[model samples]
Target chain A: MEKKQRKQSPQRPAFLKVLQKSGLSFLAMAPLLLGVIGLVGLFQVLVTPKMLTSLFQGNSLLDTLIGTMSGAIAAGNPIVSYLIGGELLEQGISLYAVSAFILSWVTLGFIQLPAEVEVFGGRFTLYRNILSFVFTMLIAVLTTLSLQGLS
Target chain B: MKKQDKPFAFRGKYLLLTVLILYGVIFLVSSQSVQLALLKSGTILVKILPIFGVVILFTSLLNFFIRPKQIAKHLGQDSGTKGWLWALAAGVISHGPMYAWYSLLEDLRSHGMKDELIVVFFASRAIKIPLLPMMIGYFGLTFTILLSFYILLGALLQGLCMQLLQTKKM
Candidate 1:
């Protein structure tokens, strides 16, 4: 019994150490997390659906740019993007615009920029966002063309 | 693990203070908007809290059990195709909001995970299993398949781009 107890004692301290480290990490992240949530909330209230939809002017390049920009600003869940994309498609918006919107809506995040920068570093965050934004436009155009070609 | 290169506490505090000041200004302009914003923020906080708990617990356990060498073996600079495959699979399986995953990624980075793999993980998150049905309903089966393929491809391409760019910087 003494041997077993001695063997187990090391793990107990390790577990406690883990717990303490986790707690500290959580506390460290709390303020930044709260700030991100606050910004998302403000965005939700300030950016309306009509305001987003009105920006697309039907020119493929222009609409694609507008879609990507708007989606980046209003980043949220993929589900919400699908709903918004569907609505836009039904409203006669080109697939290029909707595709770009959906892609950037899920990929790019302007509101979460600070939190991402804090976690990943500014250069990394900037490069990733820029690359993702550019890819979103490319993917949007390609997806639309592929669909058109198939149909 | 290497210590964080930059201190985050001061920046986080400043961010929080700025947000609070913004709220105060918005409140003065329109109390109703402020109220709505607070409620929305509260809702988001509630939603993310549980995920945050899971992330912290997972990271702590990982820190305790997984050595930096093991992480390096699987996801390090020399981890190769296997590492890319692992990152792609992990990214596809990951759920919840993007912010919730940042802490875990940071933990992994400390344990020697590559930055390119991190980009792959983020890019692959575009494909959500739970939301696939809804996506198909909206965009149809063929489009969904094509987009999913493109997203996976894009994830790899992006990761490669990041690796190249970082290498160039070095």
Candidate 2:
């Protein structure tokens, strides 16, 4: 078996070299990727945590409705949601608020607008994203209401 | 220089011009609050940098390891109900944002998967493997199951819609 495997390994290095080269490309892309991250971070800082707190302190349903809209505009990975979720929860935000925030964190979010628009076309992407946000909030509201009933 | 060696018109100079134009437009359109939010979230982005690197590396590795032909052989249209089931099953097991799956989906698309299956892959992302148990705790087992089923159903319907559009294009 060892001898047979050795016979078949002749072309392995040629292919492996490409994979090895991609590693350097990944490293080179790191700073550009990090710069994009910093840009997002700047957006978050500009928004101010105080504004975020006030947004969720309103009537639970309205908070969640608008939260969904806002979330669609600010999409990224779920870690952002968890951090923002924890903050909202700490500020006496309701379960509905947290739920909507979490859902929109993933389902909605405008961070992908440029890329999405590029792929799916500007009008289509905008409409679909808006529709997704609306549906998400609707689901959040229904889920919260249903949970309340169950309790 | 060989014909293939020549770059496309969209590359190099054209790309730079496009980027510069877009940046100027963005700067003009953005509000004060938007600018402040970017600054505030800058640290958060820095912290998540390592995780993004790992995720991208892992995704690329998975692409390297998982042969598209084999994936399609098991999950192609002729696989019938089982194919759809596996697409949803596989999607649930996958991680990262929906956008992360774009390349994989494009690969699968080339490998004979239908638009419906792609839709399922995108929509089924609502199910978080680690968080499902916690969701059950908060919303009850029945509710969780129902919602999951509903999402799958939505994906199926959306998939059919995409198929219809494709047929129209054809």
Candidate 3:
């Protein structure tokens, strides 16, 4: 019985080892997380909805392009994007523009690119971002058209 | 048991320092805005705390019970349609800031998860379950449902593109 109990001791240590590894991983992630939060805060204060809204000119193609660009640059919380999207719609910005903005806001992250590249490497990050950018435009158009059809 | 790389660790610290310095400079220009920014940042930190804890615990549990072989089998290069489904489901359910999941995804990648699945996961995050109500409130129910559907479709489309490109490379 004593030998059996002694053999089981290794299992407890294994779990402990996992916990330690996890703790270390979280510690290592601290700096990157803080930096991302700080950058997001700066963006929130620096870029206003009015600034983003003013850039839209009501042309479907141009506004979509601008909207995608703006969202990519000002990437942050989805909640914040919704607020800005609401404001833009109230200001008469077309759904095409607003949809593009909201979609890119969540998907593309020029600001977080460095952190992503750090974790996922350069090539993968580049491909993912570019694909996301293209899809944002495509989906935005489809979503708007679908909504129109549904209504 | 691999010694984690340390060379790039300093990069994270440098990024934080640079951003802090920027905050300091901006503080001098407008203290109120800086204060507001700090408050907002604090609020964000608070909101993510619980989620972060859960993530760390989940990651540890994953690392403990699931081996690299299992990860490869489920999310690996040959995981096929099942892998795509798994990535989409995980992305839809995941909450908190996307950056929080980066480390876990990186770990999974090292364990043989495909880049295509990773792209799928990232793209699928566009549909936030908790925030769906708010989205509907802002943009009618039909628009919300349609947008959600398109986002899922887009995610899979992006994943397909990534896989094609990766295969072409190999």
Candidate 4:
């Protein structure tokens, strides 16, 4: 097996040698990302600030869950998340909900799940998203409490 | 069933095909959706295309100039807090959609990045260091600092959890 590996290792031209594994993975990423982009485009249409306002009622836990659910469903630039996070805060939403929205908007990626699966594999994607989602809510709660303590 | 296939092929072309089909159905049901989807995707692509190009170019360069062994030496299991800091800084400084970084992260993983660092990278994205001033404007400096710290804390814990769960096997 070692001899066979050695025999197969050196057939590349010098120019192509540098574009081996990383290049191959980069090549694979394109198609996988196409679906992720497609899903994100569809989801973007479904999420709006009006839709978000409907989900929050100032209750910390419930707001956090709704914020997470909405965040997971939406995809955008982090700047957009901050803008939306500010909007959520001004519109009578609790700090917990706003924090959850911003956190998960940046961290979680239901739309990118397939791409993650393609690149990192299904199990890792599932575990990572679940943990991120849970921690997003936790961070949201903690952020609210810390704010309270500070004030 | 001829030994049963793995369904996803690791690259997830199957998932892309499924999404394509779903989009097709949407287009057929309402041609307006085609316009909407196209517009959204076009804008996203326009904004990200440059970054995508740079990232892919860097990946090829990295593959050529650096050996996977060197990558492992810096970012692999025993690289310790330095690896974590590298990941945190990378995640914090990065600006753009998550998908834009997926290819780069995959390339890194192929070259021996630890799963924990990947988790840390994703988690630390919540920090948004450049947006700190704006965040403070909305929520006050104290709230912003605490929130950012909590996010960093969460990233560390999530990375640790992902590591403990053995996500690398996937």
Per-residue lDDT tens digits for candidate 2, residues A1-151, read 9999988675234435535433453443343343334445544544544565566646887888767765655545555565676677667777676666666766654554544443345644554455456556666666667667876
- Cα RMSD for candidates in order: 3.0, 6.5, 2.9, 5.5
- Which tens-of-lDDT digit does each residue in B62-101 have in candidate 2? 4465455666666665667777787788768776655444
Error of 1 at A141 (Å): 1.5
Candidate 1: residue B163 Cα off by (Å): 0.5
DockQ of each: 0.59, 0.21, 0.61, 0.50
Q: Between prediction 2 and prediction 4, which has the larger DockQ?
A: 4
Off by more than 4 A, model 2: A1-38, A56-61, A75-97, A119-131, B1-79, B97-101, B110-113, B131-170
All candidates: TM-score of chain A: 0.86, 0.64, 0.86, 0.82
Evaluation by TM-score, superior candidate among 1 and 2: 1
Which pairs of residues clash in candidate 3, taking residues 3 or more apart in a chain or in different chains? none
Q: Is the docking of candidate 3 incorrect, acceptable, medium or high quality?
A: medium
Candidate 1 global lDDT: 0.86
Against the hidden true structure, what lDDT does model 3 obtain? 0.86
Candidate 2 positional error at A45, Å: 2.2
Residue A147 CA displacement from its true place in model 1, Å: 1.5
Better of 2 and 3 by DockQ: 3
Clashes of 4: 0
Residue A47, candidate 4: Cα error in Å is: 2.5
Which pairs, if any, clash in model 4? none
Cα lDDT listed for each candidate = 0.86, 0.57, 0.86, 0.80
Error of 1 at A13 (Å): 5.6
lDDT of 4: 0.80
Give each candidate's interface RMSD in Å. 2.0, 6.0, 2.0, 3.1
